[model samples]
Target: MTGGDEPAPARVQAKVGAAVLAGIGPRGAEGTDGARPHSDGGAGARSRSEETVDVRFPFEGTVGLWELLDDMAAAPRLVVGDERVRAFLVDVGRRLRAPEVARRHPELASLGFFLRRSELERAAGPLPGAAGSLPGAAGSLPGAAGSLPGAAGVGGAGEFVRVPRGLVFHVAPANVDTVFVYSWALSALMGNRNVVRLSARAGGTAQAILTIMRDALDDADPVVARTQRIVSYGHPRPGARRIPVEPPHKQLEHASPGHHASSDHHQGEHSGKPPRTSPVTHPEPVAPADAGSGGAAGPTAVLSAACDLRVIWGGDRTVNEIRRHPLAPHARDLTFPDRSSFAVIRARAWLEATPATRETVADGFAIDAYWFDQAACSSPGTVFWVGSPIECAMARDGFAACLAEAVARRGWTVDTAMAVEKRVAAYGLAADGVADAVEFHGNVLAQVILTSPGAAPRRWLGTGTFAHARIGSLDELADVVRRKDQTLTHFGFDRDELAGLARALGGRGVDRIVPIGNALGFHRVWDGVDLPAELSRVITVQ
Candidate 1:
């Protein structure tokens, strides 16, 4: 929703130069276009059924890799003048999103939020500042001088690491479709030519995003050429379907030891079983040279002279897989878990607040929940209260009423209600004694639990549930903050209490503690440090 009466363009480019760096290509001449060039011995060539689309790379052969990278480094400067491209991109995002259709299908909504142009641009815009700052004091490096903002020239030396011309980048993750856009943009910004392996499930969104980038680049000013020329293809294997791995503490439930033990035993039995005395069983020893060369036979080695960067955004299994590769030590892995966060209110604030203030706080909670059905990390999965039992009860009632109203306004249906019931039933069985406290409202639910100040730090104020919201006391709030499982905890209190809680929680390992409603705002700095400083490589020429 645009905040003003004035008619603003439905879509505004969030970051002007950054998208070019992300490898979005220029809009091609009007017509269907073929794939770009690749150097991996035509490995990109693959057949696709009309009904089932398969992403294909444009280039073929080893030489194509270097050529593509060179092309990308030069792409930001190429200018194409096409007005249709932006509209086409919006249409692509809309079609791929199909928000209206998605709203009717409850199951699909759980995956994540389908953001509007304003939201996407808002998120994408801040990245450029991060993207432009390289680490290692590379900011002043000769070639790096002009790459970032406020550089002497229009375009400074590229700010990111320059992957020597022939490197191949392996991208693994599916949760955030726009993630690749960021990755490719980083590569382009760094002046590296890259080939992206997209998650299979993200094919549709990837196609749309890539198509838009390509069209936008076709008309980009030559100054932006250094940031284009990236290729994307969906990896055919289903290995990319894994959930993102959060830190161990954030895992949904503790992993079963039996699972690991059984796997180990199975491996041990296979390893310890005496060589079968039978000739048939002993006849299959392969030569070491043959094993080495044979395994390499499927695809030609396409290594660049420099180290390769394998970016992974998946769960434990995927992380382990990435770790197994010889280059794993050099890879950069960022994890995003299926996390649910929440807000906490100081009981006094609720009791002392005017009717309007109470309504404002409740409204904030409702807005957070409705944003993406409370499935996003930004959504408040629970609320903790620090007040008298009576106040807690009142707050609980107010929150529930607001949640129900919000759910009704969104038009939840029988099927959605049934799905919530099934989820509750399953959670009730898991939670057993704690199930009585859980409350459901159509597709949304709240679980209120009371705990004295002295409860064990590990004790949860509420049981586990998707999009679950909980309310508890401040003392109980401290306990939850101390737990390893909690990723985000927002404290709603006046300045003094906020500072005190921040200090206490800081000591206990809380990642972030912000005001209740402002928790959803974008954070340029994380962990009290600038993210750009941590993520970038700085080079100085002087």
Candidate 2:
């Protein structure tokens, strides 16, 4: 059976070393992990004896649940201690950081770094989100992680206890398979049981990671295993729908970063239209609400209803659609909705770079663009080269060539569909006079178009689709910035210039600005929020 209909009968079997005992085909009763008969010493002992349950795998198949979950009622059954959580992350990091592991699984590279004990310490620094401010305050300020009026660590902030939000539901994106792990890590650290919903179109990476997690975590810490459930089942079609780029023929403009164009009815300035007037494009692909209800409403309904925190990641449309559904009164929502990002390279810097420097820049930028095939939210889709039209073009073209070579050496596979899409979009823009010229690499390499500032689009450019625009100076970018413009990958620019740009945007522009090649690096404080702090509740003892 494809699952999702009803709970099946319990299965029992003994496990032998690293071998998969096949399921007994539909309610036939099959396998076991050597669980003893559990008893509560009550009249309900018979019902409580069978604790293991079959849970659907987040990628392709299903696994028994015998784990803990909070159905939005009482507290979570299993509580993972901080030490246990840290140990699990360490184990995952050790495995992922292995040379052979990295060679076979490049997708999990960032996860390794993120889970590294030393790295995690640096990112957390004793207390990850301990600020002398109230919760929900200071969110407007960039890098301003909100925290209670105390610190949390081995010796400090003892009065302030970070309480888990019970159960967290993670709806991870398909393009980046490891994202779910990143999201889950924070909640797990806070001792929250999690149920991550991977994309129905999950790649093999999800399965591979899950298998390793199963092997390493089984019985090592019952709290870790029994508290978390990584699940995936058929979700509605993706590509068939998308977060709309703009509303019909209207083109919304952005002024400097310090200021915003206000429209009372506008949904988001980035989308280029007022919400009331903008059309909802994707409606057929509903979220998985209640599979137990026989495909009623949305498959996520049951999960959402039972969860205390819902971390939604996908596109803007998905975020908005999910918001339409109500959450538990005590629940909270954090969404990594559709966002666009770009890179800003100083032409003089690139043009004046020594041969070795140029090659290194190419390699770094290549990592940013090529990793995740540019499908990640952090990947820069448009590059604004700051310099004269002639010089900028020269720098852009040179960088493209160097990047192509690097990508080939790295053996980066281009998404054929996205490549074709880039070609059509570039040529289409040129034909419409929006782009001055079109650049296409038949090598399945990359595409960069020469266009005016703000002419570069956020959507439509998938994997290899890149856009370029000439800017006379840094100030020109202010007019082209959007509300959702996330990362500003730059080179040849000093701290002052970048800070000035951030100030000019009034803190409404890029939430993160990194060196040219570090665009895709994950941060503990992402999208302008302290994740660990935001995911947990800080009770002020005072």
* Top candidate by TM-score: 2
Each model's C-alpha lDDT? 0.37, 0.59
Assess candidate 1 and give its TM-score to the true structure: 0.53
Error of 2 at 196 (Å): 0.7
lDDT of 1 by residue, 1-542 (tens): 45353221111111111111112212222101123322221222211011111222221112232233333433322111111222333343453355543432222222223233443333223344355443323221212223445554644544533122223354445544445544443333333444555554553334444443433333443333232223322224343222223221112133332311111111222221111111100011111111112122011112111124444444445545333322322334333322335567666666667767766666556545444333334455555666666776776676567556644554433344444544645455346543335455544444534233222122212222222224454445555554333335443455676667556665664556665555444443433334223333344343
* Poorly placed runs, candidate 1 (over 4 Å): 1-173, 176-196, 203-211, 221-308, 328-332, 336-340, 351-367, 370-373, 412-414, 417-431, 446-476, 482-491, 516-521, 526-531, 540-542
Best by lDDT: 2
TM-score, every prediction: 0.53, 0.73
In order of listing, the candidates' clash counts read 64, 25
- Model 1, residue 342: displacement in angstroms? 2.6
Residue-level lDDT for 488 in candidate 2: 87
